[model samples]
Target: MGTRKTKAPPPAALGRAGTEKDLPDHFKNYRHVWVFIELERGEVHPVSFELLGEGRRLADQLGVQLAGVVLGPPGDSTRRAVAEAFAYDADLVYLVEKPLLTDYRNESFTKALTDLVNTYKPEILLLGATTLGRDLAGSVATTLLTGLTADCTGLDVDADGSLAATRPTFGGSLLCTIYTLNCRPQMATVRPRVMRMPQRSNKPIGRVIRHDLRMLEDEIVTKVVGFLSDGQSENANLAYADVVVAGGLGLGAADNLQLLKNLAQTIGGDYGCSRPLVQKGWMAADRQIGQTGKTIRPKLYIAAGISGAVQHRVGVEGADLIVAINTDPNAPIFDFANIGVVADAVSFLPALTEVFIRRLAPGNHIRLVN
Candidate 1:
């Protein structure tokens, strides 16, 4: 909620500030990478483990350990989630079991994670870019007075053993790599499926370090009355779908989204729309696909009439293969898409639908590309 503060480089040309405080020597001892494992309504968010998978890579690159920080109610589910983290490749897991953290409120989780970080320092902290994660990450980074990068598309270890956080800038037109130079626990949030989920090891070996929540429930400001799920709707599950058929602004009319649906149904895939479709009320919010929308990593993605701007690019970059249908060859979508068809989406969608329908008819199996 507050503006992220970056430390101004001290006047190195001159002398250090007279009031400059010295950092403790123990600060140098801080090591390893950490992920803030997010749990909502007794379910461990998938993004949390996805981050652990990535954190494991960074930790291995830096030759350090990867730890997951989970804060929630004291129960078997919470413990089970910690063990799952280890199975997913976390070298260590820090658990802050407390009643105040039963539900995801900004204040309680922030306090718990910050306390753990301060007690046992880590060089890097990663979180998911979900609504709850963004809310919690911003507050936690602010509380620790550290640098926080949101919605990073990539994370890597720099030569100096620091986190190289790469994210889209200027509304996703370009990419920028940010560093927390003098800050500890450089924080970042990766959207769901932005990183691959590591294979769960059958060995399942890791240490669980339990921490205490010093703050009482009475001291917390926010309270959770109930948990409302995004389900109970007929919208297709695009995020987890094997195939997704999405239309963009190029679809021309609100009714044109039906063509996308027809193609989706032909292939037994989910149907979705670009941001404009959602804005025009042609589709629901859950069906929108872009940076501000759901991040999808389907096995196959069909983008019709989408210009493929950076905002939309970041959201779908994880797809195994992308097929673009647009009249313009110069469309940015062509750059990243595996297959391109320079045809009007309105005209081509139906043709493709018919082709796929005939191909999947009974025992017919054929591959067609355009």
Candidate 2:
């Protein structure tokens, strides 16, 4: 168990350099939009298909092809990933399978993807903002001397065929669109669940272009020694929960948070809190909700006393129905919440919990939202 090494800040990473010049002749041939299909443990992350859907839209808009770049061990894993990529709208799949790529090692993966990009150039590259994706994307983007926007909320192609990557900026108070005008392959990393998963099709896979893993084992510095799986904990599964009830700083005290938990349990929902509570030791870090926290897409979300700042808003905006309860009428939560209750959450929560508990006990058919 050794401490993981991190990349030191390089000079080029400090500022925008060589970004003004137009695309060179050698780079002008870059075509199509490509997504890095992240494969691990014989399964692909859903974010890969999510990106394929997005890349398909961009490719269609740019009048180019949508391709999935799969880098993994040579076997059924890679083949299955390619077929699934096609079902998810990828017009093509680029497979670079090798023994060294069986498990994710930064050195081998960077070289594999970079080699594919150098030989078969693509106009745009998309990756999920997962731990592995962020690590691989940074190394690949830097190696290619291109710009990459991380955790983009939106991705689109401009009229000129350049990538328009939009993400939250200024402490999540505003969203800004970024463009890699001079870069040959514009790159962006999207957080999971930020974009809706597209409908999978039974259509046949378009084409698979296989490439060789040219690097030797001796050239790689990092290696995956073993894998360790953590046991499941009792924390809320906020990311994919159908119903979530969360509280913010306005709950007044740590003890009062129990009211939210009781309500959430009564309604068969999980409970979480805003980031401030985590800092105050009132809630665990996993229970925090905001841009820096989990991006959730629950069917019903109840926020108690949480003022919806841009950071928190970005995380939970995908909820089908957001019920916000706060004393302040002008709270930012009111701007987007479908239901607003201008009442003291301290009293409101307990009363609502009692009502739901009573209704749930007998043969009463009831809608939980009052």
Candidate 3:
């Protein structure tokens, strides 16, 4: 005789009329928050860890887990990235490894990430605001048809358990906090150094799960041709710089930017320009300082002829101490500036440069040319 199979009992109120024990699908099950771990040239970018730190906080608030998504070529580096993610307080890590992913193309990353999100829904997604990050985030958000907030200055978990992303609006004159409403995964992009770096632990514990892209050569359209990086001599390295001197339209004309450079030379600092200067073609896009431009965290930030617009405020707010020079005493910069000098940038800049040059050895520094 065959062994008798036992039947299991059904749910308690399965056959009851007007039963109230069943919870709605939306309230029953949901996963966790995830960060897109960014790696460049086989190296992990710091911003990825920053996002992980932030994701950890959000996950804690939502009573869920924090996960990191890393895509790269299979090797020790990939494993290392997963381990580091754990150290950054990630509860779980999902990784995709393939040769086609060895280089970052908008197509490969977007496809890999979207596929993962569809399979395992996450409440939030975060990425750094680097050139490559910006490229990928925009495409991914569009592909998923989800609302994305870019250049967010603030992120938090609301009491109702939603991502509150704050960003500058109306040319940085005001701030706006955006909510995704019904979007599955609320997305946002933050600059490289906007958030504080997380502390790493010696014993980081997390689970790692490997994922297969299931994509073939024929599936991928774009090929990695080549990559060009800045030379050591020509690199801006703005975020790491100890001191920076930036000028704005208050300098008056293209010619006046030269004065700003001269001041930077005397102070032994890197030189940069504001958005207006870039708009006027007085400088390249790399030199612009504002919300839409570079987010520099220099030890000392000196601004000349700048009226301190909100957009510009976001860029340089990372400075340890900000010194603003403008003719208008009511300039917005004065509100947050550590020190304020109300004077014409053209005259004040040159005078400040002269004082710095006199204080230092004549030939010890490289003079910034106009």
- Provide the lDDT at 370 for model 3: 22
Tens-digit lDDT string for candidate 3 (1-370): 3321213324542344124333336633446899999887878888898888888888998999999999998887877888888888888898898887888888888999998887788878899989888899889899988878888889999877778998776666777777776566789998877887789876575678778888876787888788788887667766556799998889888888788777776676888878888988998888788887888888899998888888888888889999999999999989889999999988888788877776566674455332
Evaluated with TM-score, which candidate comes out highest?
A: 1
Relative to the true structure, candidate 1 reaches a TM of 0.88
Off by over 4 Å in 2: 1-21, 225-230, 233-237, 358-363, 366-370
lDDT string for model 1 (171-229, tens) is 56777777776678889998887788777785475788989888988888778787656
Summarize candidate 2's per-residue lDDT along 1-370 as a digit string, tens digits.
3321223324563354234456678779999999999999999988898898898899989889999999998899888998999999888899998999989999999999999999999999999998899999999999999989989999987766678889876547878777787777899999877888899999797889999988999998887788875445574557768899999988999999999999999998988988888999999887778788878888999999999988899899999999999999999999999999998899999999998888888666555446
Could you tell me how far off, in angstroms, the CA of residue 46 lies in candidate 2 after the best superposition?
A: 1.8
lDDT of 2 at 331: 97
Q: What lDDT score is found at residue 366 in candidate 1?
A: 40
Candidate 1 vs candidate 3: the TM-score winner is: 1
Q: Candidate 1: lDDT of 360?
A: 87
* C-alpha positional error of residue 9 in candidate 3 after TM-score superposition, expressed in Å: 52
